[model samples]
Target: MKRKLLKFLNRMVLSIVIVVAAIALIVVLFVQFSPQFGGKASKEAIESYKNSKNYKDGVFKNTKDVKLDMSLKDMGKALMGFFKSQPNTKPEHDLPSTKIDSLNIANYKGDTRLVWFGHSTFLLQTQGKTILIDPMLSSVPAPHPTLGSKRFSQELPITIEQLPKIDAVLISHDHYDHLDYESIKALKDKVGHFYMPLGVGAHLLEWKVDKNKITELDWWEETTFNDFKFVCTPAQHFSGRGLSDRAKTLWSSWVIQSKNDNIFFSGDSGYADHFKTIGEKYGPFDFAMIECGQYNEMWPDIHMFPEETVQAGLDVNAKKVMPIHWGAFKLAMHTWTDPVERFIKASKKEKINVIVPKIGDLIYINSLEENEGYKFWFEGLD
Candidate 1:
């Protein structure tokens, strides 16, 4: 009996050692190849970023100035809190079978049609022009395919090859999720122009996107493409895909103004006074697509909470608001359904107009009240 016990113990120890060694090897391999591993921001851009007054004081005066509340212990406690909570009671989403070919761009009329292609990716079509925003078509939101957060659903409503002639590509930042390598590679030879925040053109240049096609804008700067004006507005957030390069690139929200209407795309932002300032500069937006999920108290200054999202929409003077940044990935500790539910409640209280569309549903900003048949996508979840 003693000899049998000794043999079992030896086998268990060997198994443990093998597992540890395999994990260590995988980590080393990943670190060596992943773009997020150690890509450096251009020294010139970094210096310019540091010298900027926006970088010196930060975006949000109240919260951005405060130190982070997160630590290893706090993370551990938050993980424990998640496990202690009850299992998800929300019913699974039985999304309809999406037919990409059936999605006709012409059906949207002269008004802008905004299609949520999961997470931050969106298909924006207006006045016969189609634009893709943060076109991340990859299944995972990491530098490597096997590493990071995977998509909750299949590919978006339409594949890159099937997309209409892209007039322009708008990028808010250069995070792997927002500016995917594979997606950019596919779009490189296809799209005509790319608009991005200042210093973010480095990543695109590295990816071989035409330098002439890329237009980088600083805060409050505006550029015209044909008849549309794209303005880079302030957002309360930092940028960096890796540890060493945080805040090296500027982050921004975009205000797109066409001949007849104005649309606001709150790329990804925390709550801040910039919203009011942006409203004053570009007031009464016809439609506003605001970030409304993947938030937590530990990083409150970098992401807006649910209630704050509504306030942001109001502050931006949006005629109609659509909550985004949720329904794609579980990036925070909150229950997956919390963002939409909270947003609905808050918007109702604030008397704000909101439209909650499904993953592939296209919403026409001008016809929001007319097209009241938008399916309650979060019905079962709530």
Candidate 2:
């Protein structure tokens, strides 16, 4: 009887090993060939990544020391929170958006007109050039269709095909929410140039974007197109599209300047000294679009609360500031309208001009007075 029991135990262990090996093999194949997983930096690109000042050991590092790795307790909280849903986490009604037409775009001779397509997506038409920033117009924010949050609204104000030839596309990082596969594929043929931080061009290259048009810059690097000068600034965030490639690419804020107008875009950052530094370097911005949503205390080092968002605007010396990174998807546990409400209150206290435009509504930064009275539009929804 003892001999029989030993033989049975050995067979069970063998079966378990075989199953584990098969699962490992499947995961390897998935990561290897799946287009959804995206392409890693090429050998040459990896060498460039290594040479960056921020690169240490094998990963990129934030200027200030930060811990990107979550504790096991925090991980436990996140995993448990996944099964629970927050009230008013998504909009109850379909949000309104203005229709965009080429004639309207061409005729607008005003100061930089920006159309926000919810969250961090913006279409800025200024000086006869159209720029698309963080164009994640996909319905979902994950690499796989079945795994992420669907967009709050049913459709975008303008489709990718309807867009005019894009002068440039700026990507902040390699997170799935910011750098979407579907949106990149749609814009690949129409974009004139793609600008991103170091090591991000790998994904674009894999997606068939022209290498000549792709220019990857390190932090503080500036590139020019026509009258506008685009500078890659710093942000306190991490980047990775998959499990194996965390922090392989850089994240950033951006400074766009022309002779007349200066704009700052805080891509995704926590409250940090970088904001003050940016303001001192390039002060009195005409407008600053700052991230103000999808934040929780659990990961306070990456995303900022709404109040911090306003303070960052003040830090950057923005004449008029707009809160973004909300309204599109619910990536955190906060109430859906919490971000804007908190932002408005904070802005009032700080005595800063706040621009609250509806999705797809065009707000000229030079004329923010016309964009007021949008208060409580997002209120009363559960």
- Model 2 TM-score relative to the real fold: 0.92
lDDT of 2 at 103: 66
In candidate 2, the residue pairs with backbone N, CA or C atoms under 3 Å apart (3 or more residues apart, or in different chains) clash, namely: none
Q: Which regions of candidate 2 deviate over 4 angstroms?
A: 1-26, 106-110, 370-374
**Which ten contiguous residues of candidate 1 have the minimum total lDDT?**
57-66
Best by TM-score: 2
Model 1 CA deviation exceeding 4 Å by range:
1-29, 35-39, 47-51, 56-69, 78-86, 89-97, 102-109, 370-374
Error of 1 at 322 (Å): 0.4
Q: Give the Å shift of residue 198 in candidate 1.
A: 1.8
Q: lDDT of all predictions, in order shown?
A: 0.77, 0.87
